[model samples]
Target: PIPNSYWATPLLLACEYPWTPANPNKPKLDAVLHAGVRTFIDLTENGELRPYNGEVLATRAEFLGIDRQAIEYHRFPIHDRSLPESIEFMYSLMEVLRDNERRGRITAVHCRGGIGRTGMVIGCWLVESGRARNGEEALAIIAQKWKTVAKCNKYPHSPETGAQAEFVLHFE
Candidate 1:
């Protein structure tokens, strides 16, 4: 378990396996290790890495000795199970990134298919990193990067309830 910082938890929650093969692609594993991935974040609220059981696969990767210290799990309860929960998860991700930036650690974030939940987290990253001006811009950038669809608002706005995007835009 990693330290319980405002940031770390969200990152763990941001964990998703979008591009990686269902059972840890060998080539991808090489690239991940090369990238200095100190930890793996699991952001799914259900905490179940569907399709291929991410937890089991990651544990196997650990057994194989691929920087096992980097694997960490963070879980957030998805009470709403709707748009609001999705947005809340993104805020948690922002905290994790901020904390990591301060500690100088590089992390990879993902969700199920790396689309809906995954896109939200990356959108927060763009805004927090100042790569985008606002949530709208952040959404656009994420969509471009991952080709995701975040259709919460009539347009592609961040979820309205979490107040996370609004809060992070000012603070970060």
Candidate 2:
């Protein structure tokens, strides 16, 4: 896991991109490998990729003398601080989670800071997976879980925007 990473479930981890913010934190390829992450989900689009050191895909180790084949990388990006536009995208994301769970694989999902976009996806997954009753419930759960792990804010904004929250609330 990266610095602020935490598990939303035993199998689903919420974490920052390995090379996020591109500063002293650096790429935590070794940490991701050591943490036993198997399914890596990226929720950031290409424009969001510009600020980071580079995109961190499971297939690309971004490190020398290290094998990253064990991790399965996936990209189902949406706009920054936004919800996925298509129902099909949500279906695909959930399908990946289901498939990975069936394989006994632990998955990690990330956007740049692992907050807004990451939280939106996790919240939607929570509702869809029946772990949460509704969007409000899911956001509350996220706030608790995220704060416990990251300590980034006294009042962390999981779905940073109202529309993002609404999408989760009305998520099918």
The C-alpha stretches of model 1 lying farther than 4 A from their native spots are 1-31, 50-67, 77-81, 84-90, 147-172
1-172 per-residue lDDT for model 1 (tens digits):
1111112122322223533455455444445434455544545556354432356546545656765555544444332213335555556756777777677665655444333444455566767777678867765544343323333233343322344344334433
Error of 1 at 43 (Å): 2.6
Minimal lDDT window, size 10, model 2: 51-60
- Estimate the lDDT of model 1: 0.46
Per-candidate Cα lDDT values, in order, are 0.46, 0.75
Model 2 C-alpha RMSD to native: 3.3
TM-score for each model: 0.55, 0.81
Model 2, range 1-172, lDDT digits (tens) per residue? 6667778888898887765345544456557656677677888887777533224443345454345565687888888877787888888998998898889888888887787788888888899888999888998888787776554664367767788788788886
Error of 1 at 10 (Å): 18
Off by over 4 Å in 2: 20-27, 50-67
